[model samples]
Target: MFKIKSEVGFDMAHYLCGYEGKCANIHGHRYRLVATLKSETLQESGQCRGMVDDFTNFKKALKEIAEDFDHKLLIEDNEEGRELAAKLEVLPNNFDIVFVPYRTTAEEMSRDVFNRLKSKGFKIYEVELFETPTNSCIYTEE
Candidate 1:
């Protein structure tokens, strides 16, 4: 199979509600995301001929995702998270707030990114998210 990988980095904050640990408190990470795409055959026609996929297109898609989460506070989609976001909104101009369907964990973030790119028509092989310099998570369909 032909596989290509692209990576992007972003800074964001999040808190794991209902958890009894330091992670339950808001914190930030310099997140690094790597997306891998694969195909059994390369394109034989068009400008992308002879390549599995255009690197520029893949980078663009990854950048869009990174920009959306950059400098934002990511919270779980729950009543407590909503309340927190609402309170933040009333404050003076601050960072962006993003609500995710799952806890703001590296594993869930990887899966979320994988599904998002897959929906955009990419044959995604996996998504790797680094929550810290030494810790990371990978999500893929086998």
Candidate 2:
């Protein structure tokens, strides 16, 4: 098998709506997102010959995906979250809010990345999402 990896970084804030911990309050992290792709056969011809995929294309697409989450507030798409987003939108702070389908935890973030890359037709094998330098979540299919 052949595999390649690429990574990008972003900063974002989030709050768990119903959690009972310090993380329930709004917080931010310097997130690191890593994407890995694997293939049993490499491209045998053309510009990508002998490679699983082009690194430039992989990194570019990953950056585009990460760009959406950069410098934004992630709010889960729930009733309370929707209301909060609306309130923030009208505020003078000019908050950038991103409505995510699930809680903005590292685990969910990794899963979200995997799905997003998969939707782009990448041979996505694993996603590693770092909420901090020492803490991370890895999402992959069994």
Candidate 3:
């Protein structure tokens, strides 16, 4: 199989409610997302002939995904988080909030990004999300 990978970066803040660690408090990260796509065959016609996919298009999609989270507060769509979000909305400083179906963790983010790209018709092989320069989480289908 042939595979291609693209990397995108964004900045965001999050907190794991009810956790007993420093991460339970709000914090930010310079997040990095790596997406991999795989296929057994290459295109045989058109501008993409003999290529897995256009690198430009792949990077553009990744960038769009990254932009969605850039400069935002990512949080779970729970009662507490929602309430906090509602309160924050009225603050003088404009804030961006991204409510996710799951907890705001690197592992869950990887899985969420993988599913999103897959739904866009990409043959996603894996998604890796870096919470720190040395820490990362990867998600892939078995």
Candidate 4:
């Protein structure tokens, strides 16, 4: 198998609603995401000959995902999330809120990114999202 990896970084804040840990408090992370694409054989014809896929294309797809989350607050779609949205909205040009269907955890984010890139026609093999420089969650599908 031929595999290539690309990475991008984004800054975002999130809180775990209803959790008792310190993570329940709103905090930010400079998250780094790495995406791996795999192919059984490299393209033998075309501009991308002998390549699994263009690394630039992979970075572009990742940049799209990064832009959506950069400098934004990711909130879980629930009661508290709604409340936070309301409060932030009142601040006018102060906050950018991004609502997600589930808790804003690295595990969920890895899966979400994996699906998103897959839909974009990438032969995605895995997605790894880092909550910190050393802590990360990796998602893959067989």
Q: Is candidate 2 or candidate 4 better by lDDT?
A: 4
Residue-level lDDT tens digits of model 1 in 25-117: 889999999999999999999999998789999999999999989999999999988988888889998858889999889999999899999
User: Could you tell me every candidate's TM-score relative to the true structure?
Assistant: 0.94, 0.95, 0.95, 0.95
How many collisions between residues are there in candidate 4?
0
Where model 4 places Cα greater than 4 Å from the true spot, the runs are none
Ten contiguous residues minimizing lDDT sum, candidate 1: 17-26
Model 2: residues with Cα > 4 Å off, grouped in runs: none
Candidate 1 vs candidate 3: which has greater lDDT? 1
How far is 48's C-alpha from truth in model 4 (Å)? 0.8
At residue 88, give the lDDT of candidate 4.
76
Clashing pairs in 1: none
Q: Candidate 2's C-alpha lDDT?
A: 0.92
Cα-based lDDT at residue 29, candidate 3: 99
Instruction: Compare candidates 1 and 3 on TM-score and give the better one.
Output: 3
Weakest lDDT window of 10 consecutive positions for candidate 4: 87-96
Write the residue-wise lDDT of candidate 2 on 22-90 in tens digits: 787789999999999999999999999999999999999999988999999999999989988888878
Pairs clashing in candidate 2?
none
